[model samples]
Target: MKKILLIALIGYGGWQFYQKQSVAQPVTEPTVQVLPDYTVPLQKAREAASLLQFRCDGRQHCSQMKSYDEAVFFLRNCPDTKMDGDNDGIPCERQFNKG
Candidate 1:
């Protein structure tokens, strides 16, 4: 009976040691994904030109525009913009004139 108990304790201690060794493995950080160098600038330019730039939000007058480019964007993309009076595809002519 004593020998059986001793064998059981030894088995339990071996199992605990094995579990500790398995749990003590060194952790490694996950690998990071990198974009190509050429695509990085293109992606940044696209974000700067589109996502962080102008959006159509119900503004319809040339007086509400800050620049000619903004008025053109609104006139071309947004609905019901009154910037182009003659339908010549040019917007905000008085606000931003050609010299």
Candidate 2:
């Protein structure tokens, strides 16, 4: 009877240990990067721009952006910036310093 009780106690302890381990393990959800609020406008612009055909005007390219914000808008909204050589979100490394 003691041997049976010992076996049952061991099984109960093992199950409790498993339950604790399972609960201790973190359940990870996929992480997503949230952009700045300024980018929100650019996202809306992209939707409008998508309707139009894109061509490298050379006159209206990403390099011509006078400011970083303008470059970001173009890079994000305009599909034909031709500035992001690395295909990164940034545009005009020589001009903007950042992508």
Instruction: State which candidate has the highest lDDT.
Output: 1
For 42-71, candidate 1 gives per-residue lDDT tens digits of 757865686347999999998899987788
Which candidate achieves the best TM-score against the true structure?
Answer: 1
Q: What TM-score, over all chains together, does every model reach?
A: 0.51, 0.36
TM-score of model number 1 = 0.51
Give lDDT per model, in order: 0.83, 0.67
Over 1-99, each residue of candidate 2 has an lDDT whose tens digit, in order, gives 999999999999999999988886678999999977664588678755654534234434654767666665566666556667787767667786773
Score candidate 2 by lDDT.
0.67
